[model samples]
Target: MAKSITQEFVKGLWDEIPPFRLVLGLCPVLAVTKSVENGLGMGMAVVFVLVCSNMLVSLLRNIIPSKVRIACFIVIIATFVIVVELLMQAYTYSLFLKLGIFIPLIVVNCVVLGRAEAFAYKNGVVASIADGLGICVGFTLSLTALGALREVFGSGTFLGMSVFGPSFQPFTFMVEAPGAFVCLGLMLCMMNLAGNK
Candidate 1:
């Protein structure tokens, strides 16, 4: 009952999407998605960490003992998260500040560690890479969509450029904490409805 590499990769796009379909990694999805730029930045950092961690975990799956597997996986994931943090600070200082602690919190993101334990550890390196990439793509898309929706409604802008006319008043609620929950809930409902059809 083995799957082809293509199938493995494709599933993460929708069937196994991180936040929407899989319901993993919601903290950052709700926290830093006030703007599309922030969302994309966070998502890319996650993609880098997820892919790197998955590859390392798959590569060392045999050497790591069962009792210490989770510990080993954390170490591997933390290494990549630190790399992401330093790189972001060096290149994208503004975004690095905007994202703040959430960047470091990527170390505990269920999506990265979950994949390391669930998919990467059990699969070949190629399959693990595909899974990581697919999941990251799905996650990035979700974050961007949410960020765009919130940004447009909340500020009447997309990525900081005004989209609405001068007469249009922004919906401040969309960018607030309550708005995050509301937007996410409505989106989840839509997803569920579409999935049932």
Candidate 2:
């Protein structure tokens, strides 16, 4: 039986979310999520790489030998990641600076390889594209949510604007690694509560 394009597509949004659900691609999730802008840039870059790699992988699935599929997929993903890296450097130097090495590290994001192996190889271009988009958006949302929370508490800002009153002081720890973990933990708890309800 063929997989429904809907299932292939929608699963990534929540059921197989890149970070929380699948637990794939945690480095950038943890590293660049200090600010909403950084998280958004990182997420968009991953989306570009993921979509392009999935498309390429789906397009070539039939031609590549199964024995070498993983290597081929990695190569394809790396190519797109490099393209994204150069594009970011050319067009968005500031965001590029914010994203830094995390952009190049897209090459190793498990979400890219996981989708290629799990969905793209077995599915057609359309379904694979949906899967890629869904996962990327899911990832973007997760990172942005975390980044925004951290920014608000840690810097008293929302996406860089000061949200708190002049009398309020910011918490420095929220922008650090421990802060990311704490925020993520709280988000997970909220998600779990929502799920049960």
Candidate 3:
């Protein structure tokens, strides 16, 4: 049975949330999530690339030869990745620099490539778009949440505004690599617990 467009979109928010549920795209989820700004910026760039790439791949699916489909899909994804990179560099140079190589790494991100190959290449344009939006939004939300958790405990701020008293002692560990891992693990555990309910 085929899913409705709404179902496709809704599943991504929870059932198939890329980082949390699917456990895909952990590199950016772990690396750039030190602050909400980095996570959100990375997420927005991915939203643009994934949605655009999915649309293009779906539109060109029939014409793309089966033998060259993967290559063709990479080319499609890479084009959008480049567009995202250029746009990021121009408008948000500082954030772009902070994200660094991770921005370009979206071309190879399994989330984008997997959707293109698995969904977009086999689905209608509208369904593909829905899938892209749903998955990207879920990813953005996950990143932002993780970033917020880290930022608040690690830095005592949310997007740079202090959320606690001046005397509050930041955990300090929450902003480091180990802290990211611990936070992600705790989140994963919590999500599992919630899903079980």
Candidate 4:
């Protein structure tokens, strides 16, 4: 049975969440999630690239030859990535600096490319938009939630504001590389447990 538009949009939230469910795009997921702000910024950049590329791929699906579809998709994705990079440089220089190379790396993010190859390339414009928006929104939420978890515990702050107040000692390790792996592992374990139930 074909999924309704609502189902297409809603699946990204939980059913197919990139980092937690599909487990795609772990590079930016683990790297920039030390702070909610960084996670949100990175997620938003991916949002722009994925949505625009999905739209364009859907539009040109027919004209793009099957033999060269993958190459064409990369070109489309890379174009939007450059646009996002430039926009970030202009308006969000601090965030651009923080995210650094991760911004350009969006072109290769599996989540974005997978959606293009798996969904948008075969769907209509409206459904492609819905798919892109849904998946990227889910990704944004995941990154933000992970970032918030790490930030609150590791830094004792939420979005740079101290949450635990003075004298509250932070774990500190939660912001480190090992901490990211541990936190992500725990979250993945919990998600699997919940899904199994």
Number of backbone collisions per candidate: 0, 0, 0, 0
lDDT per residue, candidate 3, 16-67, as tens digits? 9999899888999999999999999999999999999999999999999999
Compared with the true structure, the alpha-carbon lDDT of candidate 4 equals 0.94
Which digits, one per residue and each the tens of the lDDT, describe model 2 over residues 128-173? 8988999999999999998898998998988778898898788999
- Model 4 C-alpha lDDT per residue in residues 31-115, reported as the tens digit of each score: 9999999999999999889999999999999999999999999999999999999999999999999999999999889999999
Count: clashes, candidate 4: 0
Q: How far does residue 131 in candidate 4 sit from its true spot (Å)?
A: 0.5
Give every collision pair in model 3. none
TM-score of 2: 0.95
lDDT score at residue 101, model 3, on the 0-100 scale: 96
User: In candidate 1, what are the lDDT values of residues 59-139, reduced to their tens digit?
Assistant: 998999989999999999999999999999999999999999999999989999999999999888999999999999999
Question: Candidate 1, overall lDDT?
Answer: 0.93
Ranking by TM-score: 1, 4, 3, 2
TM-score for candidate 3, please give it. 0.97
